[model samples]
Every structure is written in C-alpha cells, then in structure tokens.
Target: MGVDFSGPEARAALGVVAPFDMELDAELLRWLPDDVDMLMTRTPFVDDVVTVEFAREVADEGVVADGVRSVTAGRAEVVAYACTSGSFVRGRAGQESLLGVMRGAGAGEAVTTSGAIVEALQALGVRRVAVATPYVPTLSHLLDSFLGEYGVSVTGHDGLGLEQRIWEVPYAATAALIRSVDSSEAEAIVVSCTNLPTYDLIAPLEAELGKPIITANQATMWAALRRLGRRPTAPGQALADH
Candidate 1:
C-alpha cells in the first residue's frame, strides 16, 4: 500500500479520551473544523452512571490515568478528556489530575471538557450563566458548584434528570430545554452534558437568547483546537468567533 498521508489521518490529530460508549464521533463531526482530525480512545464504561451516585462512584484517579494512557498513544497535538460530569466530579483537583496524567502519558497539550467550559466562559467575558443539563438535580448542582468555584455564577438551572440515552435527545427538545432555563440575568447559557447534543443548536440559541451559548462538546473541541493553536470561526457563537 502506498503511504497515504491525506485527509484526517494526515492532519494534526486531536486526541480524545471519551467515557466508554460515548457515541461522540457524531457530535465531534458537527462541532470541529473539517481540516482537523480526532483520534479517540475509550475508558471503562459504567452503566446508569449519569446520576450523582454514578458521578461519585466513577471519579477514580486510576480510571482517569488509564484513559489518558489510551488516548495519548498517537502523535496527537492535544488530548482532551471529554466527559463533563466525570471531569467535574471530584472538582478542579480531578480536572488537574486528568490533565497531568495526559501530559505524563506524553500528550503535547491537555484539557478536560469541564476546564474547557470554564475557559470558554472566561474568553467570552461571561460571568453569569443559565444551564440546561440532562443529569439529575444532584449532578446538575455539581455542575453549578464547579462553575461557581471558577467565579462563574449559575443564575439558572434546568436539569432533565435523564440517565440513559442522553445522546439520542432530539434537537427540538434540547432547544426547548435550553429555553426553559434561560434568564435575562445570564451572560450565557450552557448545555452541560457531553452526551447531550447541541452542535446544531448553538448559533440559533445564541441568537435567540441574545448571548453566547456554550455546550460541553463545543467547548471541549474549541479547547483542544485552541491548545493546538487553531482558532474556531463560526458566524454567531462567541466561542467559535474566538
């Protein structure tokens, strides 16, 4: 076979450490720029672990380290841990632990999805935000608490309380869920679950809410590309414009 150095395989790869069976490729395809590429590895999966119990149960340092080892195997310019709840479960220390593991495992640059969201909010100059999430109230509360520690206020929250098949949520329902949590006091709105889809709704929601709209996947993708020195460009979303 001729040495093929074309398409995504030849591009600067964005390594992703996804929660097992995360169904992420569809979401990544929507949020990431076509010129770049994603190389992914999966960690151990936990069934019905989208709740507070699950969050607490799965915040193991060993699991994070193992995931890092898997994803950083290739020549990725950057590696992103792409589980929002999992990243924030043990708070910032957990986030740092994940990043440290990635770097220790030889990632050129590393970021967690939760850290990416915080960076996204800061870059947009957003202080107060409304949130839409598919997690139960306890997990949703953790999301708020995590953002609060970063100086971002959670002015509103709408938790759908779903534990399974979050990725299958339709855009219409996700849009409506966002509208339910929106507040005039919010500088931005965040859709908090990586498994919950938001790529098609970002620009429209930003326009409707009259502020920036942030989602777990979009933020992580932005952070991975930005860390590798890529600037996202989109027509409406502030995160993209940066």
Candidate 2:
C-alpha cells in the first residue's frame, strides 16, 4: 500500500493575505499588495455620523471575521479596516477594542486604517499633523480628539461637511483641502477618509507640499505590510518608504 501524502499539505495556500473592506464600486483591490492573496468584504458605503454611531451595523466584527474565515479558507494574515472616520470616531481605546474583536475572531493580525495612520505618523517621525476629512465638521473634530490620545496632535485640519458625497469629492478639491489645512508647523499632511481615491495623487501632492501626505488607504496598506513584517518600497509613501 502506498502512502500518498497530499491531503492537508496539498491545500493551495495564498500567502500573506490581507483583507480590507470595500463599498460598492470601490477600487480598493487596486490599492493592496499584488503578490499576496488580497480579499474584500463590504462595509456600509455611507460616510455619515449615523454609520459611525451605529458601528456594529457597518464595521461589524462578526461580518469581517466571518468573511475572513470564508475567504482565506482558514485564517488571513491581516484583517484591516478601511474606514478612517468609522474607526477613529470612537477614539483611541475604541480602536484597540475594535482590533481586539478582530483578533478574537481569528485574525492573525488586526489593523485599521485609522490605527495605521497613528503608526505611520509615528514611524515618519511626525508629531504635529495637518488633516482634511470628507465628513462633516463634527466627525473631523472627533478625529482630532482621537489622535490626541496617541500623543499625536492635529495642529491643523478641515472637513468637507459631507454625508454620502465623500466618494464624490474631486481630486482637485482634495488637494485644495490639503493646502487649506496644511501649515509650515505641521510635519505631515493627512488626508483622512478611505472612500476618496488617493494613491494616484500621493506622489504629486507630496512633491507639491514638501511634506508627507498620509491618506487612509495608504496607511491601511502600509500597516498591513508592516504587520506581516514586510518592508516593501512603496513609492511616494513615507511610511512604507521608511
């Protein structure tokens, strides 16, 4: 009798996988690691205070953990939240609690775009930052408070006072937001909110501002890679480039 050893070892494993949330029609996949088995789970697309208040309805841990278990066949290397406002609106302890849920649910590593922004800022050696968000002013102020707990200061910031229109804000307007909030004292410019497309604008904007521009998606992907102990040369991103 021959021992054909191929059962468990034969599984087609997708290595260093990262899972991030995507709303309908989002180009989130294009922003992730190409060499890894990247996957998506939908989060509520609306960028409103209601979505942030009713967190469980949108960034629900159960939905994410279940999706992770389903997609990676067992466990994903990292489960990263793609929403900035939703993750940060709850403040610091809240993010830790949010990641706690992901870890308890079976994630190898837990990260949120908001949490990553903190790490990215620290890693880039920036303490005071300028920020621009697409949410209403209330949400923007909440983000400022969130960063304070981490010892990072939002010396300057603004929001578009938007509801569902965050995704619709033009790149020019986003660039304008950066300029509006940015100051010489701010070591970095953080363009908050994941729904906005930012990667294409990162290089040009950073070049223009002469300071690091950390967007929601940029920090999310950067943190996912760092959690995996990776050091990819992600161009135009100070967090990854470091």
Candidate 3:
C-alpha cells in the first residue's frame, strides 16, 4: 500500500510485491500513515532492460503467490503488482494473468501499475499522451506499444539508459526528464515507473506543463484505494478530484 509519511494519523494496509529498493518504500512512507502495516515481498530483476523474460520472471505465479500469501497470511483485501513496465511489457492479457495469480494468493482485488496508469488516463478523459520514464530503450518502446493496445495514443516518448541503475535515478533528474518532453498534442503526461520518484513533483509539474500528470506510484495508490471502496483526496495536482 502507498501511504503518505506526512499523514501519520491515518493508517491503511496493502500487500506489495516490489524489488528490494528503499527508494520505493521511502516514497510510499512519505504519504503512508505511520501505523499502516504493509505485507511486502521482494521480486528480483536485472535493471535497465525491459524484456519478456524479465516480465515472466516477475509475474511468475509461484513466486507472486508465495509473496502474496506470506503478506496476507489469512486476511484479504487488495494487492498490487507495483511495477509499471514489467506489467505493461507482459501486455494487457499478461497483466490480467498476473492479477489472477494475486487473487489465487488470496487478494480480493488485484491491480498493477500499468493498469492503474491506463485507468488514471481514462478517468481524466485523456486520449493522446506523451510518456517518459527512467527505463531502458526496449522497455520504453514496449510501454508505448502496450498503451496503444488500450487505445491511448502516445505522441512521443524517451527513456534513460540507466539500465539496472534504474533505482539510482535521482528524483531531480526524474522531474527534469519529464519536463523535457514536448507534450504539444498530448492531453496528459505519463511518468511511468513506481520505482522512479515522481510523486512529489506531480502537482507543481502539472501547473507548469498545463496538463494532467500520471505517475505509476500515484496511479497505483489511487487504484488500490478505489478498489477498497475509498476515494483518495487529491494530494497532488494531476488527478486531485477525478
């Protein structure tokens, strides 16, 4: 679950399958309630390149089921596949298959960052979009194709070759990379990647870009809350109300 660290008074629970990176945990902690309990499992991956093999490895049913089962123990609510390109690379059908695994592991509701990004774009009524990410070239192209399948047009896109150093991508660089995109015909900007730190910049960037900004983490959190039958108050500019 993505909880804001600033709002310590409110607690929420979520089960997450993420890589062994503190950056993602740190970002989620910022918005998560202090008392929130998260059941987490680490998924191993080689950074930088987005490949079908990598996608398959992450979405391995046995691995995901084991992780989800460990976290949930017995209680069930919602579970999220926290990777953006990983899920998208697997394509829509692959994503649903992963969700099925999560449900099999005892998740009442299941979602992925890729699915959430699409849902967020649809919720905002955005059709044409420009996508940016701190991923390798292959992954970026895969994301473009994945979105196209959902009927979302990606006008332009770019990716950083930081490869496995994806976790090392700085927050400032992430914001700058997103800002550098020319979103002329795009209705919104999608900063894809939960591991990349883009949440804090969502509001300010939206004001400057004059369009909605959808980040992987933000969309995943919003989708999880919605699945739980709760509406999150807009903390950042992009999808504050909608």
Clashing pairs in 2: none
> What tens-digit string does per-residue lDDT give for candidate 3 at 1-242?
87777753645577777654425776755544444455667775445244556655666777777777776774446877788866887788877788898898888888888998999999999989988987768767788888988999998887776555466777788888887774689889888877788766888888888899898888887787677655554576657577
- For TM-score, the strongest prediction is 1
Q: What is candidate 1's lDDT per residue for 154-182, written digit by digit as tens? A: 88899888887888889999999899988
Give the per-residue lDDT digits (tens) of candidate 2, residues 8-29.
4322122121223334223444
State each model's C-alpha RMSD to the native. Answer: 2.9, 5.0, 5.6
Q: RMSD, model 3, all Cα superposed?
A: 5.6
lDDT of 3 at 52: 51
> 1 or 3, which is superior by TM-score?
1
Candidate 1, residue 190: the lDDT equals: 85
Q: Each model's C-alpha lDDT? A: 0.81, 0.70, 0.75
How large an RMSD does model 2 have? 5.0
Candidate 1 backbone collisions, by pair: none
